[model samples]
Target: MGMTAPARWLVAVGSLLALTACAGTGGSPGGGTQRQIAVSTAVPDEPVTLTLAYTDDPPSKALIEGFTKRHPNVTIKPQMTPFNDYVKSIKLAMSSAQPPDVAQYNPGAMSSLVPAGLVLDLGPWAKAYGWNDRFPPATLETLSSDKTAKRFGTGALYAAPGGLSVLGVFYNKSLVKKVPKTLGDFETAMQQAKDAGHAPLSVGALQVGGFQIWNALLNVLGDVKQYRSWVYGEPNATIETDGARKAAETLTGWVRKGYVPAAANATADTDAQAEFAGGKSAFLITGNWAAAALEKQMGDDVGFFLMPGPTAEPPKVASGSSVSYAISSKTQHPNVAAAFLDYLSSPEAAKVQFEAGFMPVDTKTDMGGAGLPVEIKAAFTPVAQANGIVPFADYASPGMIDKLTPGVQGLISGKMATAGFLSSLQQSWNEHHGS
Candidate 1:
């Protein structure tokens, strides 16, 4: 199909800006960067095959199927990698002579790709598809960053979200009799569960799951802008604050009360989830990405809610991230690669995303399902509508994860003080952002 006059105008404008950005950056490794390519809204009728290197499976594979079904001539070949290996190896793959047409965006990997100019700046395509209006503004912001990629939330657009996710609490209905109205009430429930010989919470302090619990608490307790500015790498930003300290104290208190597992530091996230699903724990603090598996295991016994605040009524804030994708600058077919991204905001794609246990990029799409998803959607709507979602704390710096995971483990093990935990994270942020 030919482009309409308005679409043609958008293409022209997008092409001009993209060309300027690419030229300033120059060639990538292996001399594979396309610095002079033109932007277009059309894909040719001839058969085309594109390779996508990704770690996340369900939504990645399923979304590809949904896009290719619409354009039968296009074939997407996926190169799956384990998440741990993908983050360490993707930079080399993207810098190769024959790079995948697209790859799932990883902050660690993209930190190198952005500076090397190995990933296409998707600003032009974002404009052509009116992505600003179609997707959540904050979701898009996390995918963008400065040319150096040292900071996020501004500069060239690099990716589009395939699926959205939020961090919250999941409870076993048989263990908790009612939803807690406040943070105090929530603690009371945990105490009751402990008295009944049930572990109040299952924590996976051995990995990111440990820090995620602190993050969910920080979302409700900390000032959203302060945390966001710190995560986005704004100059002079600091994570050492009263709110952050309070959040840290709360986590340590959970440890003292015997609410967190003694073996938390040795538990992997999947193991923690399995323990909860098997009805060994009353609650598990995790992302919506775990909903599908937990639903299958526990059936009608699983429930979800954002972590309650100190007061009965509090600002709806939560930490979240997207399974977003970026196109390689070496790809011969940028337009075709971008078409798949455009489809991410469509109604059909929304259904596929939700069914695969992810929140859709189009937050407005009605998730016409029941059980755990319905509960998640109900808890998620107000936060997204209020624009209260913030990026994960690990996004604060490339090395922030290194500090967070272990710092949280120390807290669970009764070795680290709250002040020390906050300072360790701030130390990593300082190293990256400059004090």
Candidate 2:
């Protein structure tokens, strides 16, 4: 069977993208001769060692352990890089002569690798392992893209998601008496929190935390298909729209209403998260990646919810990303590497992925734990089932995060108008994908 509609819808939402391979591996993704490499579902019986480069911790380390445990003859060594440095350094690492056999995907810093033919196209393995049915189509879609890496969805299978994440609201239940039922109620709660001498929202405007807030708002307020097209790099895609402008205005209004802290622009994501966990803020808007940390800090006082919409009933839309992996064209063991990728969606791996604070690749798998994790899984189920999760806004272009962080910072500081912000984003997109 072909990819499901939800998978097709998420073609543009690349995340934790494995976009590179060692150079001189195969033909370009744009229609060049594809390497006729063989694939297999089994690893060799002899001793084998594969090196892995990644940034995320819990899932990568634990998943690697789980996979290696099943096949003692295989030893997978791991190299962990910090996020910012990873973005700047991964391209070089993957392009080096002795690149890791497998590497985690990071779209912004690694798009160049795809066009350079430095990454393996896993079409054969996907076909062999029947990944189309084993993993979520949307997760697979997030990794597949054209040769240019500018547009995703209808292209070679490059990476497979090891874990999934979705963005939503994390509230301090001790402070929010009633969870908001609608967008208006959400605003009212924030206002009350502010009036009661609490910061309504703790924003990390110094980095991605700023745009993440705007992104969550747009997920609820904007037209999903239009936003998806823009992120997907479809020709003529544009962020200049009524929904985006309204989301921007909504954020600005929150700032003026004293719901957002005055020092928001100065705060970093960790600091803002700390503020919320410390009970200084009524709510924190972020992804499930923070669930483990927050639960450790606040225990039962913390709760989770998707950002509400204008009506009592809200759309299930949310921005999400994945910790995906790809094989290198230079690997001596293509079949063995493919085996590791294929293991990602297994029931055993699902347990490891869930315990690592990510939504499992097998969305249908029950996350059999309790507390905040259970709450997150409960909130995430319907959205994943509906295929409502889209990629973060920065996935729109290689340098889009540079534009997003400062653009949303301007919105929070009242230094940038909505028109200018949208125009600037479009300018970046046009530069990368053409107007």
Candidate 3:
């Protein structure tokens, strides 16, 4: 499950506030003297205690336990915050005198920390741990950013992922008899479901779920580099292109054809998932994060698939995110923190991540599971191998989510034209990135 529209808005505002707060401080917020850290691949033998601040439960708590078991001398004090408070509070916490050594990375919410030089660049540790081989390149790309933190994909690495996730389609096995192999087949199946008096696609158009569907469509139809460039905030990158227009049109077309529920704009993500789980709709577009809940409700009646492209050979592309963490620049035990991050890529840690309901960062590691997990792995492995997974488009700018959520709702309600909706998105991009 992705962050809700309100959550994303909060993160954006929190990020701006963080940046403004940092600027007022005149330097790194704590005003500590800068110290150079010597990169080391090994953790110290002496007893050491480090603190970590995070929001997510499963991977964070489990990963910490795994790391402590391996290095008994080291103790990690975890400071858990709720997702709503995490973004706003974390900035202040990280800027404090006794900051956590390790903090979970929230790209949209914590990006301001990068420009303030409050987070350590993990480039040296990445090489020392051979992380390039340990984690998928595509996963790392989202965690890397320039010193300004505005551009992504080509800069010093800041965070390393503990767990990964991928976006795709989920179907009610009773409604969709055969899995769709091509985009045409997918539409036809949706139409057939509609003809049978079922809502073909369950959508939460009031939130991130709406734009997520468009995001998946663009991944399969658009130029990968162009989309990447736009999301990464590269110079002259623009989202007002043919492929994006086509994707918007396609989403609106589905709504006009009655394939999507009429009440989608009023629905919440969890409610949409509930409806799908109850077999009210034939299909749902979402991430692997929802697999556990779906499996519990649908049992063997649920199936997963990558969103197919126009051709039989579907595009090897998808949108995803990670449960990743960065070392605070103020940490005294940088090497120990690096060791913990490195441990995340290990086979043992991979098992923990998978069991915790996330895709393992180490794509090569075998995640042996039945049903939905297996289906997810089957779809994700090849994409990871080809380095095709990309970060969500809302990551482009702080206000981008504000545009996407309502823009999609407009499309669903027939309140805004495709061109107008797309222009509204570009306008937000321009306001953030500048014309």
TM-score of 2: 0.91
Which pairs clash in model 1?
none
Model 3: residues with Cα > 4 Å off, grouped in runs: 1-34
Which tens-of-lDDT digit does each residue in 1-435 have in candidate 2? 365423421221111223222322344334466666644455667999999999847488898898888878889999999876887677887778888989998887547888877788887777655678777676777788888898877688888899999899999999997989899999999989988989999999897788988899998899999999999889998999999999999999988898888888899999999999999999999999999999999999999999999998855888898899988776788777877887787777888998899988877777675899888888887887777889998889987888999998898887899999999999999999977
- Once model 1 is optimally superposed onto the true structure by TM-score, how far is the C-alpha of residue 282 displaced, in angstroms? 1.0
Query: Residue 315 CA error for candidate 2 (Å)?
Result: 3.5
Model 3: lDDT to the true structure? 0.84
- Candidate 1 error regions (>4 Å): 1-34
Tens digit per residue, CA lDDT, model 3, 150-173: 788987898999898999999999
Clashes of 3: 0
lDDT to native, each model: 0.85, 0.83, 0.84
Query: Model 2: runs farther than 4 Å from truth?
Result: 1-34, 56-58
